[model samples]
Target chain A: MPREDVEDLELELLLEALYRHYGYDFREYARASIKRRMWRRMMEEGLATLSGLQERVLHDPACMERLLLDLSINVTSMFRDPTFYRAVRDKIVPLLRTYPFIRIWNPGCSTGEETYSLAILLREEGLESRARIYATDINAAVLQQAKEGIFPLDRMQEFTHNYLRYGGRCSFSDYYKVYGDRARFDPSLLEHAVFAQHNLVSDASFNEFNLIVCRNVMIYFDRALQDKVHDLFYRSLVRSGVLALGHKESIRFTSHADAYEELDRQEKLYRRVL
Target chain B: MVVGGSWGGLDALGQLVALLEEGCSLALAVALHRAADSPEGAMVSYLQSRCPLPVAEAEDKDAIQPGRVYLAPADYHLLVEPGRFALSIDAPVHHSRPSIDVLFETAADAYEEASGAVILTGANDDGCRGIRHMKRRGGVTMVQDPCTAVRREMPDAAIATGAVDKVLPLDQIAAVLNGLGRA
Candidate 1:
């Protein structure tokens, strides 16, 4: 038998074992992505085989933690697409202005780039004072990084460029203090932000929000999982609240498409109409 | 040719595969970064339905052909010889077995000047080095414009290497491949 076929079966067995042994539900995620991540790590760590890696994961808590981090793709940058931020500033912020108090969800908020970016944007728009921002991810390593709010100083140039392109009204540097070789964002920006662990694949909705931005995160999920997260987003949104997706993700074919109208098609912004 | 990607890569691969014109003279194999649980055959089936070329799940030691798209089945590293596909129990590269780099490197050694490599939308820097190797060995290099990519990291990394010969939008990539087919 081909080793890949056997590895595929082993991966299925590993997923099952993980759920039975650890209660982390990843059975529904897109399989190929998962396999690639695991296989990539296996090569990096010098494991002899998939089963060998599985044995290590089953026995070692630290190993499993590392595996979880590897499985979660947390590549993100501040103000990733400036135009998307501008759309939020113009279209979503106005509606947020009407609500006396608001909650916003940033699901799969890797390394807190989008979380902090949203917080900074809301603070500038005078909405953070009355808003509660919940940023959740399955990766604890990235969450720790997010909480630090310390980014490489080398990235400042690019961040500044993206900020300007996204329609920043103030100097992008105004929001953060540059320390030695690192830029530490103002802690004040995070005053209303809550960083926590929430798995979109397994966690239940804990709070409803006036706006939910789950950008660039859902493409890793299979159609069923995407639909599940869409249901979670639909359940978590207040009627007439807004939803923002990454440039590629859409609710068009999902169950939630009817629940939201495309507010800005180019930016993938939507508002719950039903 | 070997292909690899994750996140926003599915549509990108579909377009790339569909662009392979009928009766073209090159054996193409793709290692799509996909989940082990998702149906691999469906993507091949989907591409087969659209393109005039044959598309299917790659089998071990399958003959490489022009005008064909062979997907690296989930969880395996797909390697290539001059005219055949090989599977490896060898470790994954950059955390992926059917790694784009592994395929590109091998194909670079084999196909050299005749090779054509494309890196599309993905969240990680998986294809950068692969595209570099392809170009180093005189293979044609094409990258999706990161600005328009759904997940720009892969193509962005390739462009950052200064190895990409052409960077086009996703919609325009098929035409380029079609043109190459005609040429």
Candidate 2:
């Protein structure tokens, strides 16, 4: 047998162990990405192989926590794609205003950058008082960061630029107060926001929402998992509810594709017509 | 698979495509750095017209077929997983979303010794680490010669890794790829 095949088997075993022991099912993640991350963890720990890394992780809970952080992609920024925000402001916000009350679910909201962006957008559009933003992620550590409402100060410039491009009304600096290397965002932005730990894979939907924004998260999952999440989102949304995905993600190949109408295809915004 | 980046990539890719024989069976995947907001399907249309082989943007979970060329969509990292191709919006690597290294590394893992990786015309050092992974996985690695490249930084970086097996000019790359397909 080849060494690569051996490593592959070891990886599968590790994922199974992670599922059985920790209730974290990464078994359906894109294999190549998982392997790359696992190998990186192995190198970081000075382990020679995936099996060695798995052994250490199984024995040490701290190691497992570190592994979880590695597996959960935390790459996000405030208004990362300004154009998507622009579309939400121009198209989605108007429809959202029609409702007397709004519930927005941001599943897989890593560190809550986009969630905060949405909150600010709602506040500017006079819908913050009537909106409830539920921000959830599989990782609790990132949830804690989201609740803190603080971000790196260096990123403020870029975030401000994105904010302006996305039709921000007030001075971007009004949203956050910088203290040295970190900026503490205004807590009022999250006044109606709820930060909680919710696993999209294993957990069931808790509430019906008017809008579901899950961007860039499903791309990490395999087809079956993607379909499962789509079903969950479909069920969680009210009729005519809006579903916004990352610019690259689409509902085209999913089972529920035909149920939704494209509100803005380029921005991946869809309305649940069925 | 063949990969290229920034400088001189358009011209080099055209030359490389022109050199290929009419019906090579090996499937090719190209990852190029593109702005996140670029018009969809533009690159695929442009490349399709220049190459004889059918060219298209790789869709998520699509089966990888032979005798076709797949271009990575902007803002997504193209990944090869067994018999199918997967797309990811996972954060950028080397500051590139459609990173050449991500594609090359995944291809190396999927095809192993049967894989062939090419690094060409780019201003950044994105594909260097990926080519090293390819060689370590017993795959063939090639880079466009720096002197012939519009920008030398990328090819030079790949060559600096010492994992490259060939450093061919743009005109010679397609013939080498054709030879590999036949082999």
Best by lDDT: 2
**Candidate 2 chain A, poorest ten consecutive residues by summed lDDT:** A68-77
Model 2 lDDT at residue B33: 84
DockQ for model 2 equals: 0.54
Give lDDT tens digits, candidate 2, residues A19-134.
99899999998788788788878999999988998899989999988888787655677887788898998999899989999999999887878888999899889999999999
> Count of backbone clashes for each model?
14, 0
Candidate 2 falls in which docking quality class?
medium
Q: Which residues of candidate 1, in runs, are more than 4 Å off?
A: B1-183
Worst 10-residue lDDT window for candidate 1 chain A reads A28-37
Tell me the DockQ of each model, to 2 decimals. 0.06, 0.54
User: Model 2 — TM-score against the truth?
Assistant: 0.93
lDDT of 1 by residue, A118-233 (tens): 99899889887899999898987888888899999988887887898788888888888988999998888889999998889888999989999987677566667879898998
